[model samples]
Target: MAEKKSSALFVCLGNICRSPIAEAVFTHYVKEQNLSEKWIIDSAATADYHTGKSPDRRAIKCMKRHDIPMSHKARPIIAEDFKNFDYIFGMDENNIRDLKRLAPKNSTAKIELLGDYDPEGPCIIRDPYYDDGDEGFEEVYQQCKRCCQAFLNKVS
Candidate 1:
């Protein structure tokens, strides 16, 4: 039989910032480990405020600096997503609560905080949209990198 591709959906309050970065970082990390072909990666938001909008400009720039190409449109978490993804990672506790609330009782996705996978640092991927400059964005990138690496190691 053909091998099944594991899928992951990264999420935050809005898709523009943290979630997209996490999605991009995880995608890049998987490719670096030569497991990209075995995985399906994407991102979304818990709210529809930025639906259809592109990832935040700061996030785009951060990915550029890392030489990781990223292109994604904002979208809210949907019921179908609960069934489609094998894993759904939220950036913070609020996201986890919202996702749990939105998910159907029979939903198959394993919902959890992405930061929980971090070996070091805070267990929350703080929102940087309101922060000054790119420092917050950079920190998000670093956290995502660490979390993604650790998460992948445990699952794969």
Candidate 2:
């Protein structure tokens, strides 16, 4: 019989920055390993702000610089996401609190801070939206890359 797919949902306050980067990096890594089909990956926001927007342009540029090809429209987390995804990763403490507050009683997803997976990095993927420049985006990208690698290593 075919096995069930492992699904992940990356989340932040805006969905246009940190979460998207994490989604893109994780997606790129899985694809590189030819394991994309075994997983369902996506990103979302904890709130409605920028709900229908594209990821922040700085985030796009950061991905481009790394040649990761990020392309995701911003979206807020839906009630169903709690049930659909196997893992729901928040970018920071606020995101984690929000996710837990919104999750249904029967939610089966393992909700945790994505940075918790980072072996050698900080346990918070700070928002880069209000930062001075694209430099913050790069930092976020690096954090996501490290966390993604560590999470995947633990899971796989």
Candidate 3:
């Protein structure tokens, strides 16, 4: 018998900050558990503001500080993603709203806030793109780490 594969997509406003952090955190957790083969993880944006761009430099730095490797190009959420992913997780209310608006009528993905899985934190992943310092990026990384761990525990 073979293990079943599950897929998740993380989303945010621009795909260069919060969403990519969540995606990377979750991927790291999965790899650590040796379950990477059983999961398909990715991230996207509700807007195309940074389409094809790398995640924010601050976000990359934060991930590096945590020793988690990340590599992703920004991309807008597409209708097909709604059907392909088993779960579609948004960083905040606005991301959820946009996902809901873009999801196809027949989409099978379970759309919800990524923070909903965080047992010890708020149910909203804040964006750090406009923050004055790296603190915001660090905060985002911490939140994503907790949320991703909890989410993995639930699904695995």
Candidate 4:
């Protein structure tokens, strides 16, 4: 096998919810497929609002229901991320636009909407904070699983 090549960055506004769940689900799914070594994967926020915080408990609980563990902490996107990650996936358009503002000039990082990978078409995962429920997290988690699976198929 020619060495597989890829690196992915998941992004959201706060990094305390959606993005973290995406990171956990993608990491778990790729590992189970034994393709973890082929790619670099991580997550960050478009805003610093929740920097240094752990994922929201609601999100953690939701992911746990799916048997996915999320031990990763939240961090805001850094200048280096625009250079380091091959792909930067945002939880929604607003996050994507915000991240674009921070991206380096002439950035080659492939910024995208995470849901674009959803077979369901360009739908954004809803934010649960507004409603205080895991329903949103669960929906995003399922989409992340499908997307990551599709990504692996394309890359590996």
Clashing pairs in 1: none
Question: 2 or 4: which has the higher lDDT?
Answer: 2
How displaced is residue 152 in candidate 1, in Å? 0.8
In candidate 4, where is summed lDDT lowest over 10 consecutive residues? 120-129
C-alpha lDDT of residue 145 in model 1: 95
The lDDT per prediction is 0.95, 0.94, 0.93, 0.83
Model 4 regions more than 4 Å off: 1-5
- Tens-place lDDT per residue, model 1, 1-156, is 879999999999989999999999999989999998899999999999999999999999999999988999999999999999999999998999999999998899999999999999699999999997999999999999999999999999
lDDT value, residue 45 of candidate 2: 95
TM-score of 2: 0.98
Consecutive 10-residue window with the lowest summed lDDT within model 2: 117-126
Per-residue lDDT of model 3, residues 1-156, tens digit only: 987789999999999999999999999999999998999999999999999999999999999999999999999999999999999999999999989999999999999998988888699888888898999999889889888899999988
lDDT of 2 at 140: 94
For residues 44-144, could you state the per-residue lDDT of candidate 2 as single tens digits? Answer: 99998997899998999999999998889989899999999999999999999999999999899999999998888799999999998999999999999
Better of 2 and 4 by TM-score: 2
Q: What is residue 26's positional error in candidate 2, in angstroms?
A: 0.1
| Ranking of models by lDDT | 1, 2, 3, 4
lDDT, candidate 4, 38-81, per-residue tens: 78889998878888899998888888788888887889898889
Q: Over 4 Å off in model 2, which ranges?
A: none
